[model samples]
Target: MRVPVELDPDVDDEAPTGDTITVYDKRHYVTYLRLLDAKAEGADWKEVAQTVLHRDPVADEFRTRRCWQSHLQRAQWLSREGYRKILEQAVANKL
Candidate 1:
């Protein structure tokens, strides 16, 4: 999937939690993928926060870690469950 160029660099301290995907999830689709990839590769959270989430770990450790953890959790959820919703939407659109 293409990384969305228009995605906002700023991330919320905590990602939204729900059974259904939100507009925030759609907007940060690429961010979620990147976070997943980083996790799989054993990338450090500090580096991931700085590079992927655009947060300064040194400047705000607590907030940065919170954002990373929340986003990573959301990313995993997207991989495990949210993709099904996306597929359903795609199929619905094609019908």
Candidate 2:
């Protein structure tokens, strides 16, 4: 999707707590899909971080790993809980 890798420093590392969809979630939908796929295929985090998430592991190992892990966790959360709200939003938008 050629999505930009400009991670917002202000956004929390954790996913939204409630059944609410945020602009960040909407923007990173493709990213979430990529993450979910990578995880299901057992792809290495280093590869996923640099290739998918576009973070340089060599420059900052800790931040790169943390970002990858946090985002993957959030993606999993979205699959389990957040997609319902997003579906509702889509239905509302169509109406």
Candidate 3:
């Protein structure tokens, strides 16, 4: 299930899981979680995280809040653009 990703410098994406998406950043952890809602469900958290985030180091601030786990509990709170970025990233990783 390993895949490769070629980052585009022009794209604003760069945040790791659990980190806050800056106004400038096109994607973030929350975005990915939202996309997973329709793409997968129940017990798919780990897979979605691994695939979208690739286990990138999450920020300490976000980690303290356990935001990723917390989001898993709620399960649906991302915006449309956020969701699109998640699917885009997932597709990018496949290339």
The number of the candidate with the highest lDDT is 1
Q: Model 3: per-residue lDDT, tens digit, 1-95?
A: 33323332222223333433334234234444453553556545444444443432343434423544544433333443345655766698889
lDDT of each: 0.87, 0.75, 0.42
Across 24-67, the per-residue lDDT of candidate 1 in tens digits comes to: 78778888989999999999999999998999999999989999
Off by over 4 Å in 1: 1-8
The candidate scoring highest on TM-score is 1
For model 1, state the Cα shift of residue 41 in Å.
0.8
| lDDT per residue as tens, model 2, 1-95 | 22344433333444444557776776677777888999999998899888877787899889888888888887888999888887887788789
Candidates in descending lDDT order: 1, 2, 3
Q: Per TM-score, what order, best first?
A: 1, 2, 3
- In model 2, the Cα lDDT at residue 47 comes to 90
| Model 3 residue 52 lDDT score | 43
Any idea how many clashes model 1 has? 0
Q: Is candidate 1 or candidate 2 better by TM-score?
A: 1
TM-score of each prediction: 0.86, 0.76, 0.30
